[model samples]
Target: MLVFFTFVILLALTVTNSKQTFVILKKSREDWILDGIGLFFQGIAIPFFQIAVVFQLYQLLLPDTRASLNLYPIAAFLLSFVFVDYLYYWNHRLFHTRKLWFIHQVHHTVTEMDVLGTSRNTLWTSFFIVYLWIHSLFIYLLQEPNWYILGISLSSALDLWRHSSFSPTVNSWLYRCLSPWLILPQDHAWHHSQFIQGNYGANLKLWDKIHKTYHKSDQVPDSLGINSSLSLSKKLFLPLE
Candidate 1:
């Protein structure tokens, strides 16, 4: 729901505000098809994955904790912002390694940044993502706290914004203050650069800083994605192979 709604809103913004152009890649029909296939596979996998997550959470929960909501909803909600982002940082870093890079490469293939562009990886990419699996399990174990849902809602909105082409003007004090800790569109746009190793944060920049992978610079990347071209079959199956 969050992903769907965010995509719609951002796409609308992109279309309406035509004058503010930040497109890096010229999108083609092939690109749209690839993203659509990925999105379809992702939607199909999620329900099945959640079924497993539910069963696993049931097995792990204490007998007395059944049918209970989070005792500390606020803390759980606040903590999810840090916890989920922390998990994303490591999961993302792992994708850049030699073995996993192929699975993630599709996302960077498009030089452009957009709401749909971010979800353009191969079918299995989302299935094996560590952060998604672990985060879902955690939410189930916590009994679906309201705060946790709220935190995720806020984070998902930001996620869409970061993937979109708009780079917010950083002149405001709020931007300056949050720029260090939170990821903005500019921060993530650079991650799609050919130099894709650094800036692996999801919502917060703290993990990248701690791991010494944070990158900030005035220079926009010269180019995006690798030069290698992949066939449709390869794009769909090479990651698994």
Candidate 2:
């Protein structure tokens, strides 16, 4: 329900922004296919994999530990939103390294801020993401995972928003409140820019700041994404040197 609401809000924002909507509509056919397939894999297939494969494997390997965790609701939420988020911050940073950039570069190919391109990546890229494993393990171990699940849903929704051009205005109260701590759309746009070296966090800017990787800017980059000569097949399957 929350996820649905978030989608509705993002769609409304995109529709209301004529320029943003035009940019989205103007995406190339290859962009459409890559983003569409990536979204489907991440949104549908990954969750199914988490449940049917990862969670079940945990059940088999740790049979006696199922629901062994009895954390308070707030603790559970923080476990996902803070601790796991911190882990993912590093996970995302690692993807920018030369060793792993091949698998992650496809995601940064989006030339604009559009929610549809949020999940753009090679099909198997999810396997390397920390969320795929940590989320399932925690869900399997938590006796009452409602709060944790809420955290996951909110994080996913925020990812969609931060990847899109649906941010609150800089002069607005909402932007003032969120910009100080949270990762915003413009912040992430910098991460997706031609110089994709910083702002690797998904939720909070704290990790990036602490690690001295945060690129503070009020304006979006003049240019976004890197030029890749790789064919569609390579973008979807093969990794480059």
Candidate 3:
């Protein structure tokens, strides 16, 4: 979920690429609506979802338990976010595979990169996330701290970075200062490429590499969109089915 927050940074990166893209977004209704909705869901709704799932997990872990204003709950939240991002790497890849592409193609339908471009996803993707179940499972198993909720919050907030068009200054610095421990804009953008038969992890490229899904690139993509046919209304509603 915090992976979702990093997307805002990705949006900033996209804007820095050129003023023309910003000008174009300012004129589009979809951009405005998508940003508004994405912000709310990622901010308010996502926290509520986390809280709800954490509460449920507590109850399941101790069927007769009542929560204290304690630290353990927060720890559980943090552990959940860390684990989810790892699982999400593969889940995101699954979305791009044969048969599954029918769902993920909706996200790729966006032909451009921008802040709003991240919202171009099939609604069903949400259901597939099953955030509550996964979060609950992590809490039950890890018995992590309540303070860890901070990580979950941070993870959701930073997800904005994944969809941004912004290139990094560290293209040269990453190898020295960073390890491919987590996913970056360039890694995610690879998932949106016209040739996306491989490299599909989000939030971490290391998993992609280990899984033999990694691809190296020197530039941000010049084009993006789904390879299949779709209608606007269908794209919005297909997730329901």
Backbone Cα, N, C clashes tallied per candidate: 0, 0, 42
Compute the lDDT for candidate 2.
0.91
lDDT of 1: 0.73
- lDDT rank, highest first? 2, 1, 3
Between candidates 2 and 3, the one scoring higher on lDDT is: 2
Which scores greater on TM-score, model 1 or model 2? 2
Question: Could you tell me which 10 consecutive residues in candidate 3 have the lowest summed lDDT?
Answer: 64-73
| Between candidates 1 and 2, the lDDT winner | 2
lDDT (Cα, tens digit) per residue for candidate 1, span 57-143: 655765555435554877777767788778878888898899888888877886666666666777777766764565555565676
User: How many backbone clashes can be found in candidate 3?
Assistant: 42
Could you give candidate 3's per-residue lDDT for residues 49-138 as a string of tens digits? 656866565676766434322446545554555556677777776776786877767677655555565655555455566454565444
- Model 1 has how many clashing residue pairs? 0
TM-score of every candidate: 0.84, 0.96, 0.72
lDDT of 2 by residue, 1-241 (tens): 7766876788788878889789978989999999999988999999999999999999999999999999999999999999998999999989989999989989989999888898999887899999999999999999999999999999999998999887888889999999999999999999989875899999999999999999999889998998888889888886532
Best by TM-score: 2
Question: After aligning candidate 1 to the native by TM-score, how far in Å is the CA of 42 from where it should be?
Answer: 3.6
